[model samples]
Every structure is written in C-alpha cells, then in structure tokens.
Target: MIMKAIQKYSVVLLLLFIAVSIAGCGNQKEESSAYSIFYINKDITKIVKQPYEPVADITDTNAMIDEFLGQLKTDPEDVEYKRVIPKDVTVLDYSVEGELLTLYFDKHYSSVEPVEEALVRAAIVRTMVQIDGVECLTFYVGDAPLSDQSGNPIGVMTNDSFIENPGEQINSIQTATLVLYFADEEGSGLIQETQEVHYSSNISMEKLVMEHLLEGPKSEHAKSAIPEGTKLMSVSVLEGVCYVSLDESFLNQDYNVEEPVVIYSIVNSLSEISTISKVQISVNGDTSGVYRDSFALDKIYERNLDYVDAEVQGNVIEEGATEELE
Candidate 1:
C-alpha cells in the first residue's frame, strides 16, 4: 500500500512541473509579439494615427520593414483605416544607420499620381518613423533621390517634415491674428498690416509667420520687403534667437529699398512671437555674408519700432508723427 501511494505522489509532481513549463513558454511568446504602425488620412489634408496591428515576430529590421510594407498593401483588419501604399510599388532595399533609415524603392514609386504623392509620402514617413531608434527617413527611387517641386533635394525627413500642421485631429482649425511689417508703397518706411493666419501645429509659429511674410501682403498699399523668387531654405530657433536662411534671390531687389527697412521687417515680424527675442538672417546657410552693400548680414537684429508705421485708433500714422487733418 505504501509503495502505491508514493508512485501516485511522484506522478502528480511531474504533472505540476510540466504545466509550469508550458505556462512560461506561452508568456515568452506573448512578449515577443511585434506591432506595425500605420498612418490614416484625416480629412484628406493630414495624416493621423490608427491602432497598430500585430505582426509576426521578426528580429531583422529589413525583414520587419518588408512585413510591414506587405501588410500595408492589403486592407487593414480594422475597418477604420485604409491602406495608402499602392500594390504595384515594392520596396527594393533598405538600410538603417543610427537614427536615420533610408528606403530604396522601385520605379513604381514615381508612378504614383501627383495628387496622391503627398498623401503617400506622408503615410510612409509617418509609419516608419514611429519605430524605436528611427528619428529621420530618406527616400530613393531607382537610385535617384527624391526632390521637391523646386528641385531641392528632400533630405532626411522627421515626423515634423511632411505635415503642415501636427496636433490632435480637431473638427475645426484655430486661427491667430498677426501684425506684419512690410515695405510701404512709397518705399520709405515699414507699413504694418493685420493678417489672420490659420495656426499650424506641425511648424513653429515663427516659421509660419515668415512664410506668410515671404508670400507678400494682400493689401494694395503695402509691398513685400523680400525680393520675388527668393526661396526660404530653412527656419529654426535656438535659445532666444530665430534664425532664417534664404536663397541668393533674397539679395536681388528690383525696387530701391533701404537695408534697415528690409532687415527690420523680418526682425520685427518674427519678434512678435513671445519666445523669440532677436532675429538672425542667413543666406544659403551661411551667416557671414553681405545683404546688398549696406548692412552686414552676420549681425543679429533687434526689433526697431522706429521703422514701423504705427497704427493709432484705426488710423495709420508715421511713427513719432501726429495725424494731420484731412
């Protein structure tokens, strides 16, 4: 009787150990499960997030990208989002370096319609950058780098690159009023105008204001200080100073305008941002250059109210001058 009882106890112990081992294996598998990020278009203007789908566990980054792209070709299991990548396009190869990921695609990438280009690019960029350790992305189609409309190389793009505005998806957009300074019709002083702007969440407010200023003013009485055809290379803020980089065309001026008027127009306009205290201008990324023959471009500029034509009680008047009776 004792021998039979001992045999039953050993069998029970072995069953318990086997059950524990099976549970541990199951947990490990669950922890190794992978997820793929997808971008869904919001209102045809912006890209928004969708729930990530679980993918087959893969260790290699290239293989992981392949699986993600393959999944993107098919309709997502969840109905809330639709696939943006064209089925004809295929990923030729990819490489990962530090924080940047480069994707090489076949000729089908260029075959995407012009109207759908932005949407497709946004979708791909937004999806890939979400992965850990990937901060920027570059694209190549058949050994040729992607270029923008102006033929400028679209270099490494971060999450803030493609989206005009980055923020929560709201039903309506919010706008802010801006006081911009422009060259007066007479070309003697700066004219102040109030502009209503739709604030962009993806871009810095100062950059948006500079872009609008570059577009020139709508009012017939004011003129743009920035020369026509001048391209904005980049805009960035470091510490309290806002740095604006422009192309060579900024030096070309058809009308006779003072250096101060042109320089202060940008300085004062950008200084309206609460965080910015000064403005620095650069040409083609070079800070040391001459803007015409008058002002040295290397120096930082502060806001000068003397050049601005101030507004008084709904009437426009020259600074330090009283309104004369009409």
Candidate 2:
C-alpha cells in the first residue's frame, strides 16, 4: 500500500514542475515584445496619453497659430515690434485623403508679389513640417494648388485633418496643419513669414574668430552696437560667403568711432560666421542702390563711420540694484 501511494505522489509532483516551466517560458516571450522602442501602435488612441512625449507633435499647431493671430490684433500702444505679419486672406481648407495631405486655398497670395509669397510659404512650411506624422504636402486652390483659406470642394467639413502616415486613414480631431505660406491677398495687417533659412554649412579658423568672438554684448571693437531685440533684416549666403544685413540702427546707434573699426567689427563678426570668407555690409536691405551707388556708401564706411568705445561709455547701473546682473 505504501509503495503504491509513493508512485502516485511522484507523478503529481512531476506534472506540477512541467506546468511551472511552461508558465516561465510564456512570461519571457511577453517581456521580449515589450522591450522594443519602435513599436508602432495600430491604435494610437490606446497608447498615446495626455501630454504626449518623445514622439509628440513638435508645434501645438492649433494653440500656437491662434496666439500668433491674436498678437496681430494687439493695439500699437501695447506692442513695440518692427514688422507684424501681414494677415493673408486666402483659402485655408485642408484635408487628408489617404497618405497625401491636401491643402485647398485660393490664389489670393500671388497678388502680394512673388518675393513676399515665397517668404510666407517658407515660414508656414517649416512650422508645419516640424509637426510629427506629416510627410508629403499638396496644395490645391479651387482646381489648382492655390485657393481660399477655408473653402474646398470635396467634403462638407472644409477644415484640415492630420494623417498618421502619408497615405493612411484620416484621423479626425487632428487638425490638418495647412502648409500655407501667405494669407489672403487682401490681408492688410502685419505679414508673418514661416520659413527657415540657413547659410553655408562650414566652419573654419577665420569664420570661428569672426563668428563667436564678434557677436554678443562684449566685442573687442564696437562697444555699444546692435541693441537687444533688434530684428535681423536679411542674411545672404553665396559660395561660402555670409552677407548679413540687420537694422540700420545696429550701426548708427552703436557707434561713436572711426570708419575702420566699425567696418572691421561688422566684417569680422560675419566673416567669422563663415570660414574666413568675405563679409558685405548693406543698409536697410540693399548692398547696391541709389543711396549706395552714387555715394559709394560702402567706401564711406572706410572713412566717416564713428564707433563708441564700450569701455569708456559703459552702462551706468544704479548701485546695489543688480539690474544688469539680473
């Protein structure tokens, strides 16, 4: 009787051991699947949480654009900005048909001069492209790639939609960030651009010297030039050359010195940005014009320019205020 009981008990223990081994194997498989970082969730709604991180959309298109528009309506007394973005009144209808993000708008922008149109497009595209889940963008205004800001023919809902993949199902609530460059043709207010422009992608010894050592409040030469919040007008790059044109006040206000130092300071600062390449100076937005050519304004910089030495006319700070430090 005792031997028979022992045999049955041994069988039961063996079965229990096998069950435990299988359960351990199953857990290992689950752990391995969770280890991958690039898992594309078919249902993003199930995975994406409030305040998405890592793979979050770069710009909160809905919020930022609204704030940008609100800034325009601000009273003149409430602001001190140089150029407000001109509000464009073109159609801004956007929708997603599969992977292609279609933008429908009117041709109201082309009337605002080609250069203005180009600048506006660049700005909008850059901002939208910064968003996640956006790839190819198509523009259609009426029958063409130009139209009004809010009208489209295909669907009843004329607003935009964000598509996860370039050619996938359109996810509702995802506002199709319109890759618009310009506003309505008759947009009268400040014109806001949306482009990102860059100069030569190089670094050299001379470029290094002029670049870093030239900018900032403390320069070896010009003491009080280029005030804070000065708007950069234009930066032209040609064959490793960087010609920067800023507000005229950058030069006129920051100086009480001879021509050579002023020229040297500006040239060194910009040339340093590029690798020892030449730097050119222009007033307002022209290197050569009636104001430039007749007087040889470039040459006048070699003689009559005056720059104030920063060491002598340093900022007068009230004692114990710590304002400058702050």
Candidate 3:
C-alpha cells in the first residue's frame, strides 16, 4: 500500500505544482486533509505519512525541525555567533535510494558565495545527516545533486558511518546511550536521541527552547510551516552561546508570509534545549549580507569584522568613497 501510494501521488503532486493554497482557518479543521494539505516548498516533494508515520525512539523528525526554529525566536541576538556564509539555494525533490536519503535542492544550490566548495560540501551534508536514522544523504538541487550553475557535479560527500543497510522493518529499541536504535536491511543501525547532548538527562532545557506548547518535547510552530524533509543542520555550543547552522535551501522555500518563522523556532529551540543562554544563526553562512534573488547588498563596515577583507567588492578602501571620473 505504501509503495503504491508513492508511485501514484509522486508524479501527480509534483506535476501540477501550485504556488500557494489559501484555505480559511474556520473551515480548516473541518476540511478534508486532501484539500487542507499544503505544499511546503515548490521544489520540495512531501508525501504525507498516513497510516505509518515515522516513529522515533528519542525524538521524532518533526520535533527536531521545529525546535530549531523556536530557538531562533527566543534568542535572535545569539543568531550571528558564527560568520554567516552565503550559498545559492533551490528546493528539490527528496528521495531514498537504498541506504541513502538524497535531498535535492534547486539547480543553483551549489553556487555558494562565501564558503568554498569543500566547506560547503562538509557543512551542508554532515550537519544535516547528523539526525537519527539518516545514515547517508546525497544532496541534489533540481534533478542534479550538488551541481554548479553549469550543471557540473561538485559537492557530494558520502557518510563515513554508512553501513550497507536495506529495507524497513517494525519500530523497536536497542539500548546503549539513551539512544533509540532501529534496524535496516543493511548492517548499520539508526540511533535516535531523546535527551539533548547536555550534562543532565532529567532536565527539560531542550524542551523549553523547543517551545513544546504541547505535552511532548516537540515544536508546535515550525513543523506546521515548512514542508517535510527539512532537517536541522548543526547547533554548536561555544563559550556559553549556541551557534546554529542550516541548509542553504531553507531560505529559498515558499512560505505564505513572514518566512522567518522557520528561523525563529530554530533559535528558540536551541536556547531552550541546552545550557547556552544565547543563540545565533546563519543560513549556509552569510549574515547581514544575505539576499535572496541577488541584489547589490553592500557589506556594511562594522567595527568587529574578523576577516578584514570588508570592502564594497573585495578591495580594501582605506579612505572614503573615490570621486567619479569623467
């Protein structure tokens, strides 16, 4: 039944790609799920989990994505902890080919302006695949994964911990380090994390930052907003602050209005999850200078630029603006 649904809906849902559906909230609860359903991002493909939703031992995928955004809201100031890198982004279909889960972004996804090709590859893939159960991930923008503008394969990295696992079975647990492990046909095990990577497991710091308005340690806000296949890349703890990095494609997605909701939940979740008091965020890397469709956003001359290459383009203008020549 699952395979049959994937084959049928995969083409139809993808082919008739609509921009946005404006449904009335009054009728929202009463409406059938088919009509009430939303497409997360145009390039992203989401097949709703009907009978068998993905079950995790430690945390469900939904909680992870939402908690990330929540942290963004509570601690917006902590967001700029790391120098933000700018990567060109696009949303693409997500598919599982054997043991690997491939996340495809738009075709221009690989052309990052700030980080080099090597750093882009490591940051995007390693940060995202750190989630439980996802052993290996291949990133594609459009039909092509990690390609430059000219359609050349550039940033593809295989997981060091990949075991040749296949096929899915029932949900069960293997205890080792408060982890929820599931078995695949291949030899590797999917480990789920319940407690935050903090000193204490009993505390709900992770829950507070995640904004679990509900009973469980899940995110109420961001989960309902972005489409599925969205993953939290990395939350770094440095000197009493949490620095979070995210997939570049996150900025290119389609939300009805106020897209920063995605970011807010992430930052807030981080503030709540761990002992860190502050949180900072950057999409793919670029901070104040990030623009979506390419505007001539000049780099502001801030006092604390660490790299020292802060110029309009790349030149160092020691004096003020030069006079126009005839």
Best by lDDT: 1
Error of 2 at 260 (Å): 2.3
Over 1-326, each residue of candidate 2 has an lDDT whose tens digit, in order, gives 99887544432221110000100111112222111111112232211111112223425544433333233222223222211223453445666443234555566544643223322332333233323333334455456643222121111111111112343322211211111111111211111111122212111222223222223333121242233343333343445555444445544433233334445454444433324365555554455542211433343222111332322223222321465467
Worst 10 residues of 1 by lDDT: 16-25
**After TM-score superposition, what is the CA distance of residue 252 in candidate 3 from its true location, in Å?**
2.3
TM-score of 3: 0.25
Compared with the true structure, what per-residue lDDT tens digits does model 3 show for residues 10-74?
A: 33221111101011001112122221111111112111111112224437543542332222112
Best by TM-score: 1
lDDT of each: 0.64, 0.31, 0.31
Question: What is the Cα-based TM-score of model 2?
Answer: 0.28
C-alpha root-mean-square deviation, candidate 2: 27.0
Evaluate candidate 3 by giving its C-alpha RMSD to the native, one decimal: 25.2
Q: How many residue pairs clash (N, CA or C atoms closer than 3 angstroms) in each of the candidate models, in the order given?
A: 1, 48, 41
State which candidate, 1 or 2, has the greater TM-score.
1
Estimate TM-scores for all models.
Answer: 0.61, 0.28, 0.25
